[model samples]
Target: MADDFTPRYGEVEQMAPGIRRVLARNAGAFTYYGTGTYIVGNGAVAVIDPGPDDADHVHAIRAALEGERVSHILVTHTHYDHSPAAVPLKAATGAEIVGCAPLVLDDNGPRADAGFDRDYSPDRVLTDGDVVAGSDWTIEAVATPGHTSNHLCFAYREGEALFTGDHVMGWSTTVVSPPDGDMADYMRSLEKLLERDERIYYPTHGAPVDNPRRLVRGMLTHRKQREYQIVALLKEGVKHIPDMVARMYVGLDPRLTGGAGRSVLAHLVDLKERGQVRETDGEWRLCATSARD
Candidate 1:
């Protein structure tokens, strides 16, 4: 959970035993420096999360694997910043586009990022427990549907690493926008990771997460605390989302207000679905069953 990552843009740097990461040039609030596209294995490699459609990043990925065969272009999700490069990379290497199924939900107020990729047609869509292996390494699909309904985290057998897409991040909590981004499913997915035993997590956005279970536990607690805060506010007669946002987040960045509202909405949806809260004519209030929670 360190923010001291140096993006030597378009250069591949060794992370774990069989994992090498290349940073894309696209940087912003969401993408820490840029997308961290990973290459697994030595001779016949599998590229994980080929980032945005930057020609330079694509060329750098191809350059790094010079004289090597790209057996698979494994994608974690179909966000614009994550899966767009798979097209050119597959054309460049003839590798099959495998992993998360194509999805474009009603992304109305879900996220503030570059939006979902509607044209993300994969060659082979993987379900949970599905495996794709090369001679040197193996990748397993983990169906974690929070950030997007089709999001997946690929586990590497040789390196003991999980390629977390946007389900979890080292720098920030994932935005659970509505429709496709369900808070209940997201929380369930986080709990699912605690059942695994991976050494490290290589998220597509930020730095690698060491002691992933600890971070995951803290994330769960933080979300539960958010639920408490929202319920407390509802009980105190603070009805509007913007007012709740102003109260919960002090000195928050002005740019992230919209995303913060979306997150708050996600939490509210989760609470309402759990029968702890109810919304009437755009006004939310504590439900009769709130005391049980």
Candidate 2:
């Protein structure tokens, strides 16, 4: 699907009945157009993922909420672009910060960027199935810890739409960087979403996913293909992440090789845990059982 949605920073665009999006000015390789800060409902509202800590972005959120009371500042995760502005938003509106706890890192995982908001502490920690109610909106928390260990996707009951965060995006497949992200958990989370009946999804970085199930299935299939490719490469004597990425990602952009390597490492770690592969001195090899099965 073509991404035709162009975000206008510092301006409010009503996406649906009560949901408004204010795009931040910060845009980059990871963040598609920009960080989408969603305001759910009027009068008494809930601001989700208050973008970065840019003063202009914070002022824009406050301006968007003019004449309205912010009851909750919801965070999907603590990624720098996703949750840093919660502090300023909370201070400006006196809204309670609600979402997952701080990120938990795995020391043995691959070297990846840990750009998290270290100082962020949610006023209320929401577990799976917890609900945050507003006057016109009621958001049910769905714990999806794959993109990050503390990530949460909120389901807006009124619209039957899910705020998917980075777990599932419309424009691109989510990057699962291990240490903070787990491939097994990420796949399990995708399976978890299949059991729900949400028709639409509002992701943090791109256009709304109209066909939630189709997008999720595509994502799962893509991951499975990558895993299979990795296994095939291991069978061919490719024993390291850099070699696997080189063989798997043909004509990949030079700038993205680092991220691709990290993703390959995440898959390797998951495969090791599943007993399909084994690692010796950081070199990976397919197991005999994997070859037979």
* Top-scoring candidate (lDDT): 1
Worst 10 residues of 2 by lDDT: 105-114
Model 2 spans with C-alpha error above 4 angstroms: 1-5, 104-114
lDDT of 2 by residue, 134-188 (tens): 8888999999988888889999999999999999998877778877788999999
lDDT of each: 0.88, 0.87
**CA RMSD per model (angstroms):** 1.8, 2.1
Model 1 Cα shift for residue 225 (angstroms) = 0.3
| Stretches > 4 Å off in candidate 1 | 1-4, 110-114, 291-293
Who wins the TM-score comparison? 1
Residues 30-104 of candidate 1 have per-residue lDDT tens digits of: 777889999999899999999888899999999999999999999988888899999999999999999999887
CA shift at 1, candidate 1, in angstroms? 11
Give each model a TM-score. Answer: 0.95, 0.95
Report residue 5 deviation for candidate 2 (angstroms). Answer: 4.8
